[model samples]
Target: MTYLVTGGSKMGKSTWAEDLALELAKDGPVHYIATFKPVDAEDALVIARHKKARAGRNFAVTEKHQGLEAVVIPPGAVVMLEDLPNLLANEVFDDGDVSSILPGLKFLKALAEHFIIVTNEVGSDGTVYDALTGNYVEALSFLNRQAACLSDVVVEVVCGFPQMIKGDGP
Candidate 1:
């Protein structure tokens, strides 16, 4: 089962995704792939908050800044990708590559029996962007669409509500 959870920031997508991962994991092992790499104090705070939330949750968390294809995940693991947008940023901006994201997704999708992916909702607000930001927005949209295609369940979180966008809900 692959679940793609998406929403704007602070919409409780991560919480809902965590619950769904626990439900799917049952007695099995659950791995969390944290893709956000902090660059400043605010980002550090965000990381801290996420750590606090996951504390004692039985999640074997790995901080992966980039290269999702290189992560060594156990077979049949119920894996939750903390989010996707940052991973795309890391791939394009940090690693100077964008071609591997989809193949990486396919690899993870095949390796894990249950995959819970969380991504952001963007390009919805009527705000024009500059070239770099515009390219990022376009790339992220591509990633989200590809993820939705690969997912068995696609959910959109709105104001903490998990609204089903595709497939069956938990």
Candidate 2:
């Protein structure tokens, strides 16, 4: 089963995903697929925070900062992908506009492993933006939509609380 957890920045999405992964680890091994790049001090701190939070757990960590398409994941292992917005940022857009978002949609679908993905929901504020910023917002929105469509369960975390947007088993 695939689960998608989405919320804006500082919205506790990763915390929730980590909690779920820990719970799943009680039964078996949990694989964490980290995609964040530690480009600066702040990012490095964020990575450290995650590491500390998940320290000494029954899990295997695989950090994939780029080229996630070829990664092989184990079956029945709960996987959590932290905030995919950064991955979408690397795409080259058309017309020099870069507004399109078909590649991300395809990546999420091809991951035939049991896992949960965490992403930011950036379009909820409904704020108007310039061309470049607007394209990014649109891309995040599109990515979330595709995740929702492909996910077996959809969860929205608010104020550190998890609310199920979709559930398991028909």
Candidate 3:
């Protein structure tokens, strides 16, 4: 079952995904695909924190930014994707345009195997009024929509609880 978990920034999406992946790991191997780039000290620290949180897990982590589609997804493996939009921002295009993410969306829809996808919900955010920000937000929203369509389960996390928005209840 392909699961898509989405929420606004700082809504504990990553933490939730990690927790769920760890739970799933009890049954089989888990793959943690990290798409975020540490562009600054703060980001680097955040990455470090996540790494520390999963310090002893049996997770095979692949740091493939936009080439997430290239990785071979093992069946029944719980794959956790950190953030689709950030992956598009870092690896899909040098200019960070929305069009670059279209391919990623198509790839996600075509992947019929089991996995867990995570992303930010940018529609409710009011900061994307600028031309660049608005375009990025629009693109991410479209990408999220495509993911939601293919996902067997869609969870919108808030605070720490997950609210199922589609497919089988989470």
Q: Judging by TM-score against the true structure, name the best candidate.
A: 1
> Per-model C-alpha lDDT, please?
0.90, 0.70, 0.75
**Candidates sorted by TM-score, best first:** 1, 3, 2
Stretch of 10 with least lDDT, candidate 2: 92-101
Off by over 4 Å in 2: 92-113, 168-170
- lDDT tens per residue, model 2, 1-170: 77888876787988788878777566676777776667699989988987887888766788765556545665445667765786666443322222333343345446534667888878778789999889788877877887788788898888888888888521
C-alpha TM-scores of all predictions: 0.96, 0.81, 0.84
**Candidate 3: regions farther than 4 A off:** 91-113
The pairs that clash in candidate 3 are none
Better of 2 and 3 by TM-score: 3
Expressed as tens digits, the lDDT of each residue in 1-170 for candidate 1 is 89999999999999899988988899766799999989999999989998998887879898987778898998999999988998988887786468887888898999999999999999999889999999999999989999999999999999989999999998
Worst 10 residues of 1 by lDDT: 92-101
> Which lDDT value does model 2 have at 163?
83
Candidate 3 residue lDDT tens string, 1-170:
77888987788888788777777667566777888888799999988997888788777888776665577766456777777877868743555444545565456446534578889888775664887768667877888888887778899999878998887653
Q: Please tell me which model should have the higher lDDT, number 1 or number 2.
A: 1
